[model samples]
Structure formats: C-alpha cells, structure tokens
Target: MEATISLTSQDVTKQDPTALFSPKNPIPMETIFLSNIDQAVVFPVETVFFFQVPPTKASSTLNICEVVKRAVAEVLLVPYYFMAGRLNFNHGSNRLELVCNNAGVMFVGATSRLALKDLGNLSLPNASFHRFIHRPGLYKSLDETPLFTIQVTRFKCGGFALGFMTNHAILDGKSASEMFHNLASICRGEGLKTHVFPNERTSLRARNPPQIKFPHNEYVKIPKIPSLATSFTTQNQTSPSPLIFSNKYDHKLFHFTPSMLKSLKDKAITKTSSFEAIVAHLWRARTKVVFGNTDELSTVLFAVDIRKKISPPLLAGFVGNGVVTAFATAKVRDLVERPFCFCVEKVREGGERVTSEYVRSVVDWLEVYKGIPSTCNGNNFYVSAWWKLPFNELDLGFGRLVHGGPIVSGNDEFVLLLEGNGGGINVWLGLEREKMKRFMNHVFDI
Candidate 1:
C-alpha cells in the first residue's frame, strides 16, 4: 500500500470567505497605538492545529465549522475584538497602528476530499499543510487585509484542522494560543462567560525620554554579509564553506525522549534546563556542520517572554506582543572546540540578561531605531520554544487534538521546539539538505 495519498490544491474546496463581527457587544470605534515591538513584526504568522473525530456519540454530529464560527463570533470576539480591526500606518506617529473599527475578521470554511489517514503522519512536517491556511493575497495593503483569518477544513472522516493566520503586529504566539483556548472552552460549554482581555499596549509604550541602556547587538541598522558563503578564508586556515544556496532547504522533526533530554542535561553543568541544554547542543551541532572556518561567528536568537520581566509585571490578561529577542553569539571555534557546558553557560547568560531593566531598554532601543530589523543570515539560527504553549490541550470540542504547530516553517534559518506526546521534546527545524545529513550525525553524539 502507498504510505500516503497525494493532496492537491483541487482536493480542498473553500467557501466564500465571510466577515465575522461581535454579535452582541459594541466596542469603541477608535484607533489603538501599537508598541514599537509590535510595529517591528509586521508579517503574518500562520499555524494549524489538527483534531480527530470525538469518540463520544454527541460530538460525532458536531458541525466543526458552524460551532467554531459561532463561538468565535459570539464568545471570542467580545474580548479579542481587536482581531477584527484593520492595520494602517499612522502618519503622525510614523508607526503602524490598529484601527479598532470592527472591520471584521475573514472566516473561510473548507472541505477536503481526503480523510485524516490519507494525509499520512500528521506528526511530521509537510509543506502541503499550507493548503489549510488562508492568505489575504500578495497585492492587498495593510488596511485592505484582515488582521486575522481563520480556515476550518473538514476531512472526509469527520476530523478537522483549525488553521489561523494573525498579524504579528496585533498578537504574538502566546496571546494567539490563549484566544484558541478560549474558543475551545466555549465549544465545550466550559468557557468564560464574561472574559475581558486586558489590552496593555500602552504599558509597553516608549518613554518620553527613551533610555537605551543596553547595546542591542540583535538589531542592526545595516545588513551583514551572508555568513555562509561558497568560499571563505579564516585567519588561521583557508577552506570552502558548505555550498548551501539561499532559500533551498528541508525541514525535519527530531524527537528527544525524556531520558535523552535528561542525559543531555546530565552531560551539561548542573542546573542546566532542558531548553538551554538542547539549544546549546543544537547550536554547537549546526555550527559544526555549517561553518567550515573556525573564526566565523554564529549567533543563536530566541524570544523571551517579558510579561513578568518588567517591573510590577504585565497583567496575566494582557494580550499583545510581550516577547523580546535574546541572543548568544560565539566564534565557531569556541562553540565546537569548547566543552558542552561552555555553550550551555552562554545560553543561560543570555536569558539571565533579560531582567526588568533590560526589557525596558529593549522597548526604548526599538523606539530610537524605528524599523530596525533583526539580523538574519546563515550564521543566525532562530529558536522558538512553544512546548509550554497550550497547543496540545486545545480541544475545539470537535474531537482529540492529534497534532498542532506551524503549518510549515516559512524560513529555513528557524527552529521550533514543541511538546511531544509521551513526555518528550520535538525539535522542528529547517536546514540545507546537504548540511542536515551531517547535523544528524553530530546532534546526538554529544
């Protein structure tokens, strides 16, 4: 038998996308100013969560799309009504702001000719997963495009996939996950009746006198040369680096059992967390395979939740971009030649630096250097830990949440860490096809 059936664009038929509004509550028809960090991330983030048909008799007849659509329009939109707003550039502030005019979010319902099994191994990453998400098209401006879009694709076997695309300027990953949890809760009849989410964008606003205390090496005014080159000569040695072209990549899921993670932690210095230990291992391993020259510098960039890192702590209900980038940089020689603990300590120090004062400084820094983008090249490796996020527990009242994560990694220089079934960690990463073979050899050898 064939391992998996082919899923074509024709297999999935979508309904005419509709605009969904808050059915009962009337929100303020005003503009909300987004923070500098929010303005920095203007791109869209797409994620898909899969659910199997529930075993219970009552759930078997549930209309996954209708129920979810109703829950979003009636229950979720009250607090998260900002999601229905449109994004526009504010000429006065010279920044992008959200116009809370209740423009309504785009909701698309789809049906697939294939069943849940035909897609094959939902646990694995596949580019075809994009079929589940709805993009507003390439030509639309910010005001014309919907800040949030939801696509519900029902499978032949009654299983369903909940796909969402949100403007990063309005909501980050954490806030988006919570919104889904709220929707799921409503579908199960256990959701909040009067949920009021705190919009704390003003709290993170830049100070009148911006205080940029820390030297933010993460953001740069000018782009650097491509770190992974076809040929390069270090001070001590000369060699041709890996012939990895830009945009040609492959993604894979690397599973690490609890014991395997424990072993990694055991190998590192005492008190090293699984995240730090695993990241250190990945950084070192990828550097070994990609960087031929010892002197070449490699940087690991990751996001730090600043909700509690600031003074007085951001409110638990505060739902906006509450994350800042934290990174560690070291010479390829140091990462490869030094002991495993060396890399772990470097990773730890980066996180330790994200104190209350540091978060404020990050806000101020972005204020001064408006639109400064983070450095992204072969030398930069981005890591996002979603293991603690509530993806697995997101039961949309349809059935069991079998698997959930990014539809597909849009960037090759990125990695996503998610919680795995059976108490393990799943490393979903993308890399050049040739270097991946060498990376697999070095990842677990430590």
Candidate 2:
C-alpha cells in the first residue's frame, strides 16, 4: 500500500538529448539584464503540490511514479527557452544555462498519513536554495539549477501531499503553478501533446529602451545602520513587532456567498474601492482579535500586475518581473476609534494611487539609488490579495485543485490571498506565534 518514486539525470538523458538546450536560438541582451534583476529579489520561490488518492480498486491500477517520470521527461524535452538565452548577471562572457539543466526533480518517500507533518519539518537544503536578496553572488548559474527537491508523504486520511522547492529567479508563482499542473496532467495518462506554453508575447515586454522617470535616488533612502526588521512596533525597539495570531496554521478555502459578497461591497462602497475595502475589513478584524487593540498601526500591501496597465502592454510571454505596484496603509488610533468602513475607505484610496506612473516612479527611484541604504517603513501591516486573477485556473488537467494556497516566504508581517474552488477566498496570514492563536480563535468563533 506504500510506494516511492525517484528520478535522476540519467533517466532524463535517456529519454531526450535535447532535454535542456535549443540549438537554433539565442537570447537577447535585455533578457539577460532582466534575469539578473530577478535573481536579486527573493519572493518568487518555487514549490509544487500533489493531491494523492487513497489506494483503491481504481487508484491502485495506475503507477504514480511512472506518471511523474513521464512528466519530468516532458519538461526536460523543451528548453527553458528564456533561461537558455540569458546570461547570469548580464556578463556577456558567460554562457546561458538551460533551465532544465540547472534543475532536477527528487522523490521523497513517506506514508500518506504523515505527509503534512513531514513537510512541516522539511527545510529547503541550504546548499541548494539560498535566499537571493540575503546573499548576493552566491548562486553562479544564470538559469542555475535551483537545487530542486521534492517530498511525497501520505496524509493521515489516506491521501498525500507532494512538496517541492526551487529558486524564485527561474519562475514566478503563476509560472510554477502552470508547470506543476502540466506535469500532473501528463503523469495521469493525459499525455503531453499540447504544450502548456509560457506566455512570451507582448503582454509582458518591458518599455522599449525602458526609461527611468523618478529615478531610484528620489524614493530610496538608505539608513546609516540598516535594520533587517521591516515591521512596526508599539514602541521604538530593535526587534520587529511580533505578529498577533494563533499558533495553529490551518489552510482553508471559502467562497463569499452572494449575501456576504454584497455586504462586503456595500461596506466598501462607503469607504474605499472593492479590493481595498475588503482587505481593510479583514485586516481590522484580524488585528482587533489578535492584538487586542483597535489602535495598533498596520498596513496592507498588494501586487498590481503591470502587464496590461503599462503605456503599451508589455511583450507577451516575456516571463520576467512585470508587477509594478504595491499598496499599503496603516492606523493605530483610526483602526481602534474609527468605524471599520472608514478605515476600509482609507486603504482603498491608498491602493488606487499606485498607477502606471507611480510604478515607473518607484522603479526610477530604485535606479537612482541603486546601492544606497534606504529606510523602509516596517511598522506598517501588509496584505496582498491576488485571488480574482487567474491563479486558480492553472488547470494541469487532473481536475482543478480543490484548494491551493501560497507559501509564506519567511515574511512574518503580511497576509496573502489566493483563489479557492467553489468561489471562496483563501487567506494566508503569518504573524507572531502568540498573536496568531488569538486571531484564529476570533475568526473560527465568528
């Protein structure tokens, strides 16, 4: 009733010689620069999930490892066209490394019931997956292998969870999800006839000869002694403020019923736009219960994908960082004293100001102050909601996931949102252990 699947380079090589490289293509100079920048950031870390069915008359008929092997083979056959063309750190002298060449798939063997517990204890190999922003020049390859790792364990209830790790520079959340979906579909005898092609066209291209408007110098202010902490505290202290939430971290996906959605919209209408209003309301609710203070200062930040919002839509399938906007707002007193709806309104206004021009301004600001130490306001609370977007539609064909949630990138100051099947929202909140407990009690009680 138990099994393990392991795949290696030899198995992959035997299937296809063209697994990682393309002979006829050359990447452009600009793409190399973009890859370098992406390597500098740390948010887009890669991971994957597999939902296992219990061994039954029907389930036992299929060989899961064979399915995964086929999936890996398929991914290898195609060149990570983008990575293969770009050089690491924009060094023209260095050659681009194929994405598949840099990455490999590992199979961890464990029982289904203990899967989650096992994954919870698993840390990404320090040797393979290091935080990009924390350590510069550590990873050498342009499409450097991401020290990919995989773990398979059975759930207590006779199911399983497949966990994976990869570097953020190679893929964004959306892209990684797509790859896993395709792999799953192909593994299930679906076959890989239709390539789940990455969008590389105009919807993601950079501004031709990208211009710097405000310049990095204008917005980036470096502090004399940089403090790694980026969250606010009730008092000035060296350590970041602890997040207030219960210790039990459970992932739940729920849909907003028509009435609930309508009520939320009506509440938001009085104060901010739809997105901000909802985020603000959630922030206030969670903070109130966890912090035990209506007046604790906090901020909510979200992403604004600029592919369509830019002057001219970016090139389609461009596959680099194209998100340009983040929104934030906070109030210790206003949150405690003001009506919840009012607070929601303020958050809405703050988010709306992050237009294409604003995004350009921020980038320009970064360009000007490239190496300067900047003081970032860590005291504000952070919230990101990307559920309404196409994240859940990442159907790799074994039937859309019943639930899919985002993993926290070691950021203890924020809450993120994702889409859930059956029309609900999945909220991921990371706070101080003590605070998390209180917040969970409040939410579950409600």
Candidate 3:
C-alpha cells in the first residue's frame, strides 16, 4: 500500500521586527555581493541527499508542511539579523531577502517494511521543482527571490524523509542543517528554546581581504559561445544565461584506517611531504586504476576558507559566504607513468600556494571584475575535504550529525570529505558514469 501526504498553499508569513533591516543597521554593499559570489560558487549546482528514517511513534504524528514552515521561519530570523549586521565584503554589507514558496509534497504508499537500500535506486518525481533549479540564471541581485522545495516521500517502512532543494546563496550547509534541526524540533512540539542570535562582535568586523600573490596563469578556461553573446544581445542582458554541467553517477564512501594513514605517511618521507601528500599519493593510485594509460589531463581542486587566513580573523558567525581560495593540481600523463609520491608532492606544493595573501588577491580581482564574463577551468575532477573542517559539529540541537553529504545536482566530478562516528575518514566521490565504474573497480581491485 502506498502512503499519501499533501499540502495546500497557505500564506505562512512570520517575521520578527527586530530582524528587519534599516539604514541604521546598514551592511556594506560589497559584503552582499561577496555573499552572492560565495553562493554562486557553491550553489549553481543543486545538492540532494537520501535519508532513511525508521518507523517510530514520532513519525506518525508528523505534519510535514507545518514542521517545514516553522523551521524555515526560525532559521530565517537568525540569518536575517546576521545578514543585516554581520555579512560583509570588500564592497559593502550582505543583506538576505527571504522568499518562501509552497512547493508541493508527495506520498509513497508501501505494503511492507520498506527497504531503504532499494530507495537508493528509486527516482523521485520529475517536476518543475527539479527542472527549474537545473537551469542557470542571474543570482547576484540582493532582491532576487529565494526558493525552497520540500517533498515528503513515504517509505516501505512507514516512515518518510523530507527532501529539500534550497539555494545555497541564501544559506550554507551549516545554516541549513541548523534549520532542519529546528524544523524537527518544532514538529515534536518543542518550543523555540534556544533562538539563533548573531554573534555580532566577532561576525561583523572586516579583515583585510585576500590579495592574489601568484595568480594562476593556466586556470581552466572556457571560450565564450557566440550563441550566448547573441542571446544576451537580443534579450535582457543584465543576467547572463546560467551554465549547467550534466552530472549523473553513483558514489560510495571509503574509509582509511589510522594504520593505513601511517603507512602512507611513512611512504611520504621518501617523497618529503605530510598527510595530504600521502593522501594525494593514494588519490593518484586510484586515478591510475581508472584511467589506465590515458594522456588526458586530470585535476584535483579543493576549497580554502579565507575566514581565518586574513590579517585578522573574519567575524565569527558571519553566516554568509566566506570561502576565498581553491587549491588545485593537474597532470597530463597516465597515472602509471608517474611515481605516486611525485604526484603527491605536486598536490602539496599547489595547496601551500593558497595563502592569506593569495586569498586577498582573489578578492581584489573579483572586486575589479564583478560584472565581467569570466570563464571556469573545465577540469576532470574536483575534491573538497570538509572532514577536517567543522562541518560535522554543526549542532542545531538533535546532537551532532553522524554523516553529512553534499547535495550536488549537476556536476559529475566532485568529492566530499565526511567524518565517521567511529573516528575514520569517509570520502564520497561523484564521477561520470563510465569513469566512476572504472574508478571503483580500480579502488576495489574488482
């Protein structure tokens, strides 16, 4: 039997006057633009995750829509103040505009205990909610409308997971996590006990922005399509057409033991590097497994947060986009032709080049090139290690999350670092279908 849940459009507008923005609490305009830039980089692509909630008495009493609305309201209140006072950039303050829409929900009936393992293979409905986000659009305007999509799907186990697709420009992964926790809390009839308060003192101060020391001359470059130029010329050219990369693939997590880490580290002495060096070595090993003798170039890119790297640390709890740099390494030869240690060393050197000065330079360049059409380096792969970062400790109340995965919608070349509960590293890789299969076989020696 299939289970069903539904929601009717309702004007659920709740605002805190204290959270309202005014000239008295004006934020720098540059900050707003930077926040949008941060969102553009991280978002542009959508992120989705599958959750398995075992049937419980709590699941039965859940009113999915009400829970979501209340949670969004609470979360918005916190960020509203943060954006009003704390969000800053080289240009000005970053203010957030909230536009909440009623995205329809769904219901899936089941006859027996649902096997979540199978849900992993199940595809949800293909509606405007999924399609509209896949396309690109102008996202820099502070007044651009915010969108939230919520869908409730019943499982074979008589439980449900609320699937949400939110624009990252509006909130980061951590902020969204907090919002979800609050939503869950409100669903359980728990009063808003701990309200979100902006850490104004630490969060609003402006540190010296990043300055590029050694600008990359060989950044991945994409030539402008003449068609795009014509489209913009003929139409309203204020917003550039959005670019979407096709990303459909399978992924799994791999754990490396401490002993294994030690082995890799010890091996690195011959190469003269640290843990990241050894990990890069392993990454090459995996790459070789997939590519065989290919001569095509492959790249590894990782994020470098600029919050603390600046002269003075950025204000704490600023709650907007703060990322400043991305470290990358690339090679063209077949993985088998290179020594694993050599590849590791190259990656290490590249990562070290991303310094506070380099970050500042990037910010400066962005400031100068705000409206100019820029090209992105089309690389074979991208990897981000959030495991060592504070992503795991994003506690909004339901205890620390055991696992967190990025809900990326349109890029195939990506990797995420996750912290396991038992003190291990979880590496989630998303690759193009054919390449991913080959890569998996190489990793497992299957």
Top candidate on TM-score is 1
lDDT of each: 0.77, 0.42, 0.41
Candidate number that wins on lDDT, 1 or 2? 1
Q: Arrange candidates, best lDDT first.
A: 1, 2, 3
- How many clashing pairs in candidate 3? 33
For candidate 2, give the lDDT.
0.42
Instruction: For residues 1-446, write the lDDT of model 3, one tens digit per residue.
Output: 12222211221111211112322222333223333234234232233333444445325424543444445444433433323222112222322222222211111111213434443322221122231121223444323322344443333543443445444444555545555555555545675434753333223222356343566432322233243221111111222234332335455555655555556666556644334753475467556644544665555555555557765676555444555435444554644466555666766776677666665555445433331212233333445555554433333232222233444333344555555445555565555577666776555321
Q: Which one is best on lDDT? A: 1
Is 1 or 2 the stronger prediction by TM-score? 1
In order of listing, the candidates' clash counts read 0, 56, 33
Model 1 lDDT, residue 376, Cα: 51
Query: Could you report the Cα RMSD, in angstroms, for every candidate shown?
Result: 6.2, 9.1, 8.8
Residues 1-446, model 1: lDDT tens digits: 11334468898999999899865434457688788878766666778988887434434634778888888888888778788888877777777788888888889999988777778877666767878998777346677778889999988778888999987778888888888788888988887633768786888888889998998876653224345432111211222223323357766788889999898898896789989999998999889988888998888878888988888788886788888889888999999999888999989988988998888888898787663335455567778797877677887556788888876543555688877768888888777789888888987785
Question: Once superposed on the true structure, which residue ranges of model 2 sit more than 4 Å away at CA?
Answer: 1-31, 35-40, 44-48, 52-62, 75-160, 188-261, 270-274, 285-298, 370-378, 389-400, 408-411, 418-422, 433-446
Candidates in order, TM-scores: namely: 0.89, 0.62, 0.60
Candidate number with the higher lDDT (2 or 3): 2
Q: Candidate 2 on 227-338: residue-level lDDT in tens?
A: 4443321111212222222234332223344355557767554633456655766666665654545455555555556656666666554455555435444566676567
**lDDT of residue 142 for candidate 3:** 26
